[model samples]
Target chain A: MTLTKRIIPCLDVKNGRVVKGLNFESIKDAGDPVELAAKYSNEGADELVFLDITASDEQRATIKELVRKVASVINIPFTVGGGVKSIDDARNILLNGADKVGVNTAAIKNPPIITELMTLFGRQCIVVAIDAKRNYDLKENVNIFSENEKKFWFEVFIFGGKQGTGIDAIFWAKEAEKLGAGEILLTSIDADGTKNGYDVLLTKSIVDNACIPVIASGGCGKPDDMVEIFEKSNVDAALAASIFHYETHGVKGVKSFLKEKKIPVRL
Target chain B: MVSVAIFDYGAGNIFSLKNSLEQAGASVDVITSFDKPNIYSGLLLPGVGNFDPAIKSINENSKTKFQDFVEEDTPVLGICLGMEMFFEKSEEGIEKGFNVIDGEIVVLPSTMKVPHMGWNNLEIKKPGTILEGVDDGSWVYFIHSYRAKPKFDDVITAESDYGVKVPAVVEKNNFFGTQFHPEKSGDIGKIMIQNFLNVCKK
Candidate 1:
């Protein structure tokens, strides 16, 4: 019962440099991914996530090199995602030093890829990243987490949130888990880059539906937002980019604040 | 010098583990098999993947040789899935483990998450070299679904709470297995790896 709540800082990489955006657009450079990764690792970030935002096949080597550089510099668990399209791509990233490979579009395109990666590598290394937005049109069919007073249902998105799959996020989480994804990296596009706070309703919905460990991402503004989402949901970890990228509060600062708030975080 | 050979099962990430080991002042080698295991002072069974594929790869390639290596009294450390393979058998896979320790690997209770993934504090159960310089309640990174329950409690060096006393570290004779990933664990993990190097030196 004392499993420590994890604080993860995500580095969205574009052309080997760390980038940040508002609602997954309007990109701004943060810094070097390797340097930022080492800084986060030393700052008590529980885990580091590197998302390759570039979609070009030519930038594959850059992503691999970035993974190697960052992995060599940091000692914590690092998960790499973004352009990973196949099992071989996952293997290449992992071999370059990533502990886990995150698949978003590819997984939605071929659901069996999750199982294939899990069977080939292991369930522990396959993290299915679900980019989702709130869909107000869907009628509520699942009453499990209906207590939340949100007007919309969660919908799954792919292609870096550009193309909406119209898939129910909660149901997709359950299927992804069954397909052998060890963890769910759930990012709420509605709250992403807004700094308003995490979509706790969306997060808790997935947490209630899926048995695997879920990492809540997007819209983490400050330490209190983390506290609120963690209190509201059973997410194993919370991921933020802007707060850490902008130095609004560092990983250690957030962990200390959470620790002060009686949250069980590794300080 | 502390010499260690990390067994390569052709799955999982070994780069960070190797980097951490070298950082801890040990000369490390990634060996495909356990052939001539006596040459290294310590052998590392790094964790990753499932019990069946990993065990199949190990058994098909280095089963008898690894048995001899374990019997040689050389320090052998198994990590995560690597640790699960030290048991008689695991619920995760149908293959029988090396059975270096008397135990069965069972899935974590349903109340807890399946992977039990995250950082959790350790409760040091006994005095062991692996816990040297590491605080009794220091946190370590854990990403595992199944854990080993050695029949003898004395083998448990540390346990982490996950709605149950999940064994974090187990040791018998020169054999050591950690349910957590010491390589990915930060400062405390570095200390534990250094302590293992010291054990090899001794």
Candidate 2:
């Protein structure tokens, strides 16, 4: 089999501890990163991704230590991302046993960073993270966008979906693929932390357009949400942070649910 | 100690499989070279990614050694691409396989989606040691687009439905294969690995 549907548990780390937020607010420390990672690993997480969401300058050393600690216990593949800007940063994380390095802001600032990292460490090592929000024109009350007329645009955002770049999400996804990114972590800001469900239409737009694997992130409240994402979006993996970290749904619980739904997750 | 050699071609999920087998009461060694196969009580050929490069690497690095090792009727398990490599040839890149099994790997029809990623039910065709405790219609995780069409149907120990009779497990004496990721398949998968190690003990 060329590609398997990955069941990924995302850890949003701040100061070496797992944390979660509601709509990017009300941040609260969940638990120790290492302890949480071991728990998820035992629960059947196919892979774990730790996002150092804290600002870059303050937690560089702490994040490195956290990555090392998490890698020490978990045998499955783990990815470290967020605030990764330079090759040295990527090198340090991979040296700490991170199977992959996910780049977001750096990739947006200089798209060549994707190609550079891929050239240095192979295409399989680089994952470009895209956090997008669906733009709906209130006048039309529709999610559709018009490009050439310079009206109604589904613009892509950067810097944790706080800044809109007026770039279409579809365009950037295709461009990221062409730039040699191994995979795409597409998160919908519109549905993020809402726990309603994934932005299926937006996810499908990117998955349908791109040839590489697309990981659907955000808005996962339950295991069935994952089944819905895989069954409908054609995405290769589903990533959730709060649901797994808060013990709302264990990895084994999610895998069992998916298996029953015929969604094929690593049990 | 039940020594198990897990063949690593730099493509398969080596770490997870090693962890599972080690948990199943086996002293597992991840091997990239074919120089020594007799050190282990059994062999596991695990693979991921495309078939062409995987076959090329295995043949150039460990094919002859594997041939000699398989001659002894030692228990061997192939997972996913590893299973595809056992066939005579695969439609993917039209590459020639190990030819241990008189079968050909063909891609599933595109109308039903290419990768066929996810979990499905296994229909046991023949009971054997490898599937010692696995239920006949138990659900196992699967992630492949192409499947082996064994020249003889009797070789298939278990089959799964994905718009087709996909081979989930195949066994012939000491030779066995799994089209699903037993390492990723959770408790049931762990049991399956334990059963394979039980075979090694005998």
Candidate 3:
């Protein structure tokens, strides 16, 4: 059947607690990860993503526990990410009840991990998460493609956005897709936690190049923001943390608003 | 209690499917072999792997058991990749399917996204027990790249629109298959699981 646009609520969790961050820093506790996950699932959320923001060794055990608890209560598909460094780590998360495992920092450390996870668990379960930030300065010699004529192009980041990969975000998306990634979770580091709006220009660039589904994250302040991304870009899904976590607008409210805008959402 | 033998093909996640079956009031058992298909009232072939590898596992493990299970009039429900295996073959792989039904699995058009992920409404073509009480456009969770295309028109119970008309549900005699995961489709999913269990009770 024709796939409908998805509304996803991202829970950046630390030590089993849901947290929110501004530009990938200044993390603050929001609530329990399991509680929020269950709430989102029941409130008509199309999908849920639980990212263990701080991938510390000590918190690894708790992430698995959180996935198990969340999987038991929710009927919707949910994905788990953060600190997944190996195939065993991905396997443990899926076994513990995560429908998919997101790879960002670990994938950056080793690009082959994307293919490894895809081969072992199937592509549908491997989401290659890319945290990208805008870099305006560019030399005339270096050739890089951007959908927009804007001088700045997005750069990929690693280690929870603390380290830069110097890799072009659009180029990496195509690479990840060729490596058998099921979907691309594209988050704009500049727009993250700002609650302004999504980087429709950035989203459009990648969605045009990548063949798989792309879930646009960051800068989702209002339901109109989601509508704007859908209307402006070809993104398959939209994810936000602050607006949903703080009850700025619940999942149902966002879907209802999108439905009224003539957007195809499962309400 | 309706006992269901869930065929463990050594791939994909069965936790949710098993958990959903238990919650829907059925006794579930994860069986590696198809040796005792008659002991259970129903058989469930849940999958999440490539067609070739999955068929290899089934052929190497319990090929005859599945045929026996179906011949005995035991209710069978296949989900996602499991449903795709019901057909004669698939474009995704070279391995032939179980050939239980007259159909083949074809990939969704390249015009639309490959893996039609997320929830979409089901357009009921012909209502059956599996879709009993389910709304005509009820949303169900789906994450599949290929969908079944049955040979006979009457076999398609329901369809969903992507870029093309993707077959959502198919039923032929005692065999039933769903392209979407009923275990992950929320309340609608739970109800479909319960209905499958009810079919076993009959």
Docking class of 1: medium
User: How many angstroms is residue A59 displaced in model 3 relative to the true structure, after the best TM-score fit?
Assistant: 2.2
Residue-level lDDT for A39 in candidate 3:
90
| DockQ of each model vs. true complex | 0.79, 0.09, 0.65
For DockQ, candidate 1 versus 3, the one ahead is: 1
Q: In model 2 chain B, where is the ten-residue run with the lowest total lDDT?
A: B110-119
TM-score of chain A of each: 0.95, 0.92, 0.95
Over A13-91, each residue of candidate 1 has an lDDT whose tens digit, in order, gives 8888889989989999899888899899999999999898886889756887888888888889989998788888999
TM-score of each model's B chain?
0.95, 0.94, 0.96
Each candidate's fnat, in order? 0.86, 0.04, 0.68
Better of 1 and 2 by DockQ: 1
Candidate 1: where is the Cα deviation over 4 Å?
A139-151
- Candidate 3: which stretches are off by over 4 Å? A139-150
Interface RMSD of each: 1.1, 6.7, 1.7
Error of 1 at B77 (Å): 0.8
Q: Candidate 3: which pairs clash?
A: A2-B161, A2-B162
